[model samples]
Target: MITTRDATKNDIDTLFDLILGIAKFHNQEEYVLTNKEEMLNSGFNNEPKFGAIIADFNSKVAGYLSYTWNYSIWNGCEYMNLDDLFVWEEFRGQKVGLMLMEHAKNICKEKNISLIRWEVEKDNVKAIEFYNRLGAKITEKGIFRWHLNASN
Candidate 1:
């Protein structure tokens, strides 16, 4: 029996663990600078910077996802930007990812958001297939993209 629910303050440590797992999966572990305390403060605040959900399988924590809302000027509306969707290695084929996504979609619907968006690593074939199965279309990336850090 799998269940999904909004993440609470108590889940901060678990969330941090799951997030680190995801970062490692993507070879981005060094980028996980946010600590558990920071996650608890921002994630559970009255106005959360992002929304998080936990996936449980028979009372055991299986996985988690974090997302935020983004405004699209071309679409003239806000869309749910699924920042991260990850399932534990042991829970991969158990449909935990599907359950997490369905939970996100339901939340989006409730908020009157008709679209959900996210970018997948191009080499993640399994994820691309999964998103394709969910009717997500690929959009081409701009030829030039840049990020601003402390140093130029």
Candidate 2:
């Protein structure tokens, strides 16, 4: 059976491991530099920057969904940005991802959030199909980024 709950500070190590697992799956493990201490501080500090929902299978960590809030200037509305959604390889096809998404949707319902947004790699066809199955529309808009350094 799969269950999910809000992640706490004590789960930081496991969370970090799962994060690394996801990064490795995407072949971007080298890009992950955040340590457990940083994750703990950032997620559990006085002003938390993000929130996570952990999925467990038979009392073991199976997956997680991390999210943050953002506002749309043009729409004058707030939305939840799903930063990460990952399930362990062994846990695939078990509905764990669906459960996490439903959990997120419930959170949005309670918060009156009209939309949920997320980005998936263009090559991740499975992920795109999953999101499409959940009724998410793929926007034609392109994403552009400008990286900045703290020194600047």
Score each candidate by Cα lDDT: 0.91, 0.93
Error of 2 at 49 (Å): 0.3
lDDT of 1 at 122: 83
Q: Which stretches of candidate 2 lie over 4 Å from their true place?
A: 150-152
Lowest summed lDDT window (length 10), candidate 2: 139-148
lDDT of 2 at 149: 94
Q: Candidate 1's residue-wise lDDT over 97-133, tens digit each?
A: 9999999999998999999998888899999999999
Model 2: pairs clashing at backbone N, Cα or C within 3 Å: none
Q: In lDDT terms, how accurate is model 1?
A: 0.91
Query: lDDT of model 2 at residue 32?
Result: 93
